[model samples]
Target chain A: MTDVASKEQKLSAEENISSKILTIYLIWSVIISVSIIIVGTILFIVTGKSGYNMENLNSLITAKGSLSTYPFYIQSIWSGVLTLKPFAIIQLGVLILLLTPFGRMLLQVFIFLYEKDTTFAIIALVVFAILLFSLYMVNILEALHIA
Target chain B: MIYIVIGYLMEILVASIAAGIIGALGGLGGGVLIVPFLTLYFHVPISLAIGASIVSVIATSSGSAAAYVRDKISNIRIGTFLVLFTTTGAILGAFIEHITPVKVLFFIFGIVLIISVIPMLKKIGEEVPNVERNDPLAEKLGLYGEYYDSVLKREVKYKVTGVKPGAAMMFMAGTISGLLGIGSGAFKVLAMDLAMRLPIKVSTTTSNFMIGVTAAASAGIYFFTGDVNPFIAAPVAIGVLLGAIIGTKILVRIRSSSVRKIFAVIILIVGLEMILRGAGVI
Candidate 1:
């Protein structure tokens, strides 16, 4: 509601024309991610199970830790999706949600370049670089055992 | 067996919905409500709870940011410019989160949540934002914009000052986002409203625009660290997103004055509980 208070305000042609691509993209990304999550949840319900084992969850509460010990990567989720594993489907949705903003930064780079706004393009690129670095930096460190 | 599963998932879903409603009504955020709920009632691990909370934060933000950005009330130049510091701090904060003890993280989250309640209590002063001489950096960068305010029924144009200080505060905001797995919009709005002195509407909208990007910086880190458990995150994200959508639909119909006060009190209580949880006093 903090930001939504401004929702009913009308946008001028200038504002509307410039931001159309991004506005549509953001809405779709949220829609797609949320829908996927819903599908995953339904799959979980029908099967009376999740991609994760009930035993794992039970153990998690008792162990005072987490159920996910496997190395974090996309391949596992892909394979799980191939089998229609419910929780894996959920993870795929989560992955999309995670990517939405990163993708926004990527989209902004193109938007800026298209507009020939060199300053903003560079700024977007810098933010993109930082976001990319944030996503993969820890992975890089762990791969080298430097972390 | 199916009913049992339904009931279990429903419990999380419903609690998340309640949190979402309160968050939406109060103009607060879900992460502050959720982390404590998951930890205290659901008994989820602190790390997993944070991971889930951050994911839901993105869900709620994306929906609102879409509207703000599309309206162009959010200044792309200023938002992206500040994002540099936020993303940088987010990366640093995520790494720090890995090293800090869970108890310490819990304690910090509690303190942050309590402090966040202050601005909400103050009632966002709709009075015009502070006007200052535009800094050369802001002028060069074009950190200025105008938006039509529906209530004021006029277009308000504004310039900002103190770019360096504002950027410094954004860095801290980003660090808090990465560290706590929350948006830290309070700090962000503080930086812009009190420090940078942008118009209130612009400050709030731009803060919305930046939150998703900032959270993504740390969320990606959480994903890679295996802190993002699908079971917890899936339900929480879905529930909060749905709840927020529902809240917005009813938002215009409801009077939020009394509701905001109640929710603020609830946030204070949750903050205390999180602190006690970290201190092992409860």
Candidate 2:
């Protein structure tokens, strides 16, 4: 009975940790995504243009200068964000939303490690690696002209 | 330019809000609604619409998932494990997206939406399933969870099985999501509920958790490819996020069977419209 009790306690403790981590991640994601979107919307209204013109819609559709040269654009996004460009700020918000799940998985890796659950920790690590690989492999493949 | 910008933003915002509400109710992500709406009604290019839709998927996933996570409705272990297969599939699918023609994408999107409706129609009004047996693989992977169902007013416990099959289905779901820029939650739920024998609530919530990660995997490719237009994506994301929050709140308070049926009908109509449009018959 005592052994069962101890196990239950451990499970609850783990649950608590998981819940806490998720709550923190969710809060940050909401704050970041919502704020940037609002700023972007307001700026979009005020400026009456969104960096990309309607004339470029055709080029955007065909992906003329975008996909092949995406890495440079990604770099520009960083600088744009740092400079508080409205569109970039909006993109940054979407970026944060996209990355939140990746962040959560990374947190799970630590949580599993702390629990001494080696199998699940390794599983989490593998998922993390896949996410990171997918993010960067596009650039490499584009450079190789194999994409 | 000002009139064009306002027109574009307002249209996407309104469309996204509708998609978000419909998506949340359906347990599918907003991408399903946004992609077709953008391409069919607004005449947005398929790739940019898809990019914006993918972003909206992440927004809805994160927004609704927060509430689900807090309620302990989502099975994180199952979601995380499946992410391995889905992410790999997403990468491959993203590559396919680059090479596929717009017409072909429309055809596939329409067909997929139609196909998804079949399962929903069959499972309409079905209650949570009972699975008494557990697979050894599930035990090893620790794929069991319990959540208090607010609607039922009781704690529901479930164990998963068919791990290999579920993972395979998730791979397919991920590929479809990447290719079409939708969440493909219907397939994810089917893999869990039908193949893995998990309860419906668990399946839906866990699928929600998984969608964000799967979309994230492909979102990177979309972002770098300049497919994600901030002007289009920004309002869509915000609108969908708001709609999803409201949907999540509603999800916990009501019986979902009726909601599922209503959502199914909506999906069926949309699916047929997409097919007709793609076939150039409309």
The CA lDDT at B52 in model 2 is 86
TM-scores vs. true structure, each candidate: 0.88, 0.93
lDDT agreement with native, every candidate: 0.77, 0.80
RMSD of each: 5.0, 2.5
Docking class of 1: acceptable
- Candidate 1 stretches greater than 4 Å from native: A1-14, A60-71, A140-147, B24-29, B119-126, B247-264
- What is the Cα-based TM-score of model 1? 0.88
Residue A76, candidate 2: how far off, in angstroms?
A: 1.1
Error (Å) of candidate 2 at residue B38 is 0.7
Q: What is the interface RMSD of each candidate, in Å?
A: 3.2, 2.9
How far out, in Å, is residue A112 in model 1?
1.9
DockQ (CA atoms), all models = 0.46, 0.51
